[model samples]
Target: MQSSIIIADDHPLILKGLNDFLLEKKYNVLASAVNGKDALELIETHKPEIAILDIQMPYYTGLEIAEKCKALNYQTKIVLITFEKDEAIYKQAKSLGVYGYVLKEFALTEIEQCIDTVSKDIPYFSPELLSYLEVESTPKELETLTPTEKEVLKHIAQNKTAKEIGDLMFISNRTVEKHKSHIIKKLNLAPIQNSLLIWAKENQTLLE
Candidate 1:
């Protein structure tokens, strides 16, 4: 059976284009809304199988609407369209049970795949977004290291021995080892042999 869908976006061109595309794909598009208010009303009234919402809509953003729908126990599956590649928004979407997250730039190319996946009771996120998140996560984890720990890590990345690092930093070997232990703990690396050295080598470019 054709999936019942409602799409909304503040941009007229995007809204029309998406509606037409879904129609061409033979899906039953019940309504289109220019704002989140109308979108939520359409969703509440039509109870579509999927609601494709723009994340930055007026009155209520997509995440806000998703939260409302969840509170109301609505069964409509949400597919959020956005230009944002932000981690906080993505995490909020996941928390609100959004079924699909498509980047606005890739909306036309990716929407069908998102719908297909969501229809099968699976969540879908843009592959590009996932890659961005993975890259972002590494920097965040690296941020946990103190300045001295990071300096120690950078030296380790250059294949520096503990004594060499201690000499370069004007610290003792014991202090260098202590910093190494702290770095490993902050990075949550295993206490196995050379794990800290291996991690530093692998992420050398990030250190620079």
Candidate 2:
């Protein structure tokens, strides 16, 4: 049987583009929705095998729908698409147990593979999203940190523990650890004990 899919996005162009693409690729597009409420209705009515959802939508966000689906034990796999490059939102999406997290910029090339992977009950996150989590270094590295990265990195450099960072951020200690790991990797710091704190000290200007 051809795999069935439900797609929803607020932008008409984006919603149409994805729907057309999936149809061109021969998947059974059960329905397309312009908002989260309608999307939920279609899911409950059609029970599609996969749901390609936009992270931002009227009535309910994709993450919210995914959580509801999980609560109801629905069989649909969720793949969230978004244009925002945000670490916190990505963490939230992962926490919701979404089947995929795809950036709109990479959607055309990657969505096909994402749907395929999700069909197998595996998760897929865009490479661009993963790249942001990787360690990169330049002479002016501190100048390149995002606001969130700078905040977390600053705390680490200040000799704050993961628990302390989590308390400050109102996030879990595990989340703090994840951020710390990403900071170390992104700064391209040598994998040695206390390397991050040392680098943090060396680059105080960037954090401050």
Candidate 3:
């Protein structure tokens, strides 16, 4: 039987390209969607054999859609397409039980291979991304911090504001500020909010 597939991405060109390519390959393009919400709707309506999902979207992330599919007991094979090669996202995708994770920069031929592999009940990772995993080294150390400081860092990573974190931890606002100061000093991070967020996301697995 021909495989039925749905393509989801925010870019019109990407959606069209995938649709045309798959159609030419003799696969049935069951539906296409621009975001996670629409993708989930298409999946439920069509029950396609495969779903090709872009990781970044406006309404909800591809990972969110994957989780929903899992919850609904959908048996469709999922292929996540991403521009990012972040380890945290990679680990999260694996945890979501995705059949394949394809980097956006790979050739169309690679995509074909991924689809075929996933359809055959095998997992696939794009070659470029696989190489990244092979070469990444574990961090040696994070500067030692008190348990309270670690909690503060975790809350910050979760996007909590200083006052909000203070309320959550039942600590005074002055205490929160002091903890933040100490964290910056200990980590020697750049004195920028975005820099801190970047550090948090990049080192999330280490924190865990």
In order, candidate lDDTs are 0.90, 0.84, 0.81
Better of 1 and 2 by lDDT: 1
* Model 1: per-residue Cα lDDT over 41-100, one tens digit each: 999899999999999989998899999999999999999999999999998998899999
Between prediction 1 and prediction 2, which has the larger TM-score? Answer: 1
User: Residue 58, candidate 3: how far off, in angstroms?
Assistant: 1.6
Best TM-score among the predictions, by candidate number: 1
User: Which digits, one per residue and each the tens of the lDDT, describe model 3 over residues 1-208?
Assistant: 7678899999998878878888898887888999888988899989998899999998878899889888888998889988888888888987898888998878376888888767777678786785576358443225577888878878877888889999999999999999888777777664755656655665666566
Error of 1 at 121 (Å): 0.4
TM-scores of all predicted structures: 0.67, 0.64, 0.64
Error of 1 at 96 (Å): 0.8
Best by lDDT: 1
Query: In model 1, where is the ten-residue run with the lowest total lDDT?
Result: 132-141
Over all chains combined, what TM-score does candidate 1 have? 0.67
User: Relative to the unseen true structure, what is the C-alpha lDDT of residue 50 in candidate 3, on a scale of 0 to 100?
Assistant: 89
